[model samples]
Target: MNSSDGGTATPAASGAPRSGPRASYPAEQSAGSRRRWFVGLSVLVVVVGVALAWLGYTKFATPDVAGEATAYEILNPSTVSVQLTVTRKDPSEPAVCVVRGRSKDGDETGRREILIPGGTQTQIGMRTEVTTSKPPVIGEVFGCTMNVPPYLTQPAT
Candidate 1:
């Protein structure tokens, strides 16, 4: 027997017992390393999947309510007329919007809270006149809030 080729005998020539590819490390150690790598990869994949799901839920799965001022006109020195539209996902929910008037000097001249009655309409269009103490240069809708009516909260008398 020639002691060459790092003593790893070829089965075809030396009749040694071998079945698969040669490994530099022990079979059990290599198998264990592969298993650990597989488990780590699986965990990473799961974590990433969960993170993506949470992000999607927060960004796309929630409802949004918004309002916009469509048009405004200065009726008089202390009065301004405004037209606004409120949009919501659930139209049955009542909304309150704050309207404001600003003077030429950028001071808030008037502010009013307008009530929007709830109905089956998703988009509500409203027109109102805002009164101010000084001459108003512009009128705008600040924002809107969706809430249950106070009449619904009181107990029956």
Candidate 2:
């Protein structure tokens, strides 16, 4: 029935389609809204990635002191001598290096810290011996750092 008769007309009787929603509210999302959401998420991810890269570079990329275990010798059953070559970016800054001994089964048997005194030379080679609880097959350099403990530093004269 038409509105003039004080009765509502069914959609089937009217020209409106019975299968889908009306044009006012669509069933699927609009293209513009979806594109905007995707662009916002992409920009957030790029910003987070750049922030992480900057943090990693500043913390680890360029260390003041770096060292390498050039050679090693199994001195005896419980001892391993390691030859370390250290390079200091600022030769005037003192640094400390940690060396370790590893067993055949890849277990860390022993560790020692050697001090690199500040000097005019940028590079220094030193040989140190590490005593191990178990027989060691090789010696390796763990890392070098400028954060030296109080005991490792010499007192002012």
Candidate 3:
């Protein structure tokens, strides 16, 4: 309402776009653009999902090298002797395995890496001692790989 005219002002008279419902929305996308955007996002999601699934499978699938802690003995207050069994898909490929000792509380107390030389046999057993920070009640085989560190490859001094 204008004080001079003393009457309600219509939107046309007020020189403004209509406010509230039935107003024209800005930046509206055509049907084609909306469909293209949807397809692009779907393809991106599928690609990412496939990549992630492949990564996870590679991690948990049967590995070329495997190690198991078959038995353990408490040799001393801070030492444990672990019997490790190593198996390789290709016995000709050398592998390295990591062993660990865990306390009764399930805390890792010690860790050691040992080398397994390539041989004709697919599986072999070895006993190694792990020095722990505290007494250990259990032993575990962390993992094994054919990628032997250079330090391990070096001959003893």
Candidate 4:
């Protein structure tokens, strides 16, 4: 049979495939795909960066000395004595201690302040002879503001 009459086909081309609408992708589509991929990669990188930043800030950020305070009472008062202990996280700073007392009438009876070096505990002890003929109810409140330096806040090895 003749070739023009649909005889057995022979190999036509050589090194590369033929170029056509179905064989090759459009230039615009290829460029758009690349841009979309780049945008997706950029978004992923930004998300990862933000997550890492949040973790770093939460973990390594300095302790915010916003304010830490606690109150407690000592029972069975004979000779009323107030004691305060302050410890500094850093060795360069100083610890502050204060002792105060309040009477049954809600009056400031006594107060004392002391300072101790950093990385050390300082205690302030005070003794006051209080007479409560009418069943005394002595109230004491300790208030302090502390700022821990950065050097002493190193993470444990």
Predicted model with the maximum TM-score: 2
Q: TM-score of every model? A: 0.58, 0.70, 0.65, 0.31
Candidate 4: tens digits of C-alpha lDDT, residues 1-157? 4334433224213434434343444435578889999999999999999999999999887632111213334344422443333333453554444445566777665554433344432333333333323333453434443543444354547
Error of 2 at 84 (Å): 0.6
Residue range 1-157, candidate 3, lDDT tens digits:
5423434347545766544433434647899999999999999999999999999999888889889989989998899999989989999888999999999888999999999998999999999999999889987898999999989989989
- Candidate 2 Cα outliers beyond 4 Å, as residue runs: 1-20, 23-46, 154-157
lDDT of each: 0.81, 0.89, 0.87, 0.46
Sort by TM-score, top down from the best = 2, 3, 1, 4
Residue 113 of model 1, lDDT score: 79
Clashes of 2: 0
Give me the runs in candidate 1 sitting further than 4 Å from their true place. 1-63, 148-157
Candidate 2 residue 138 C-alpha distance from true site, Å:
0.6
**Better by lDDT, candidate 4 or 3:** 3
Superpose all Cα atoms of candidate 1 onto the true structure and report the RMSD in Å to 1 decimal: 8.2
Better of 2 and 3 by lDDT: 2
* TM-score, cand. 3 vs. native: 0.65
- What ranges in model 4 sit over 4 Å off? 1-79, 120-141, 145-157
Better of 1 and 3 by TM-score: 3
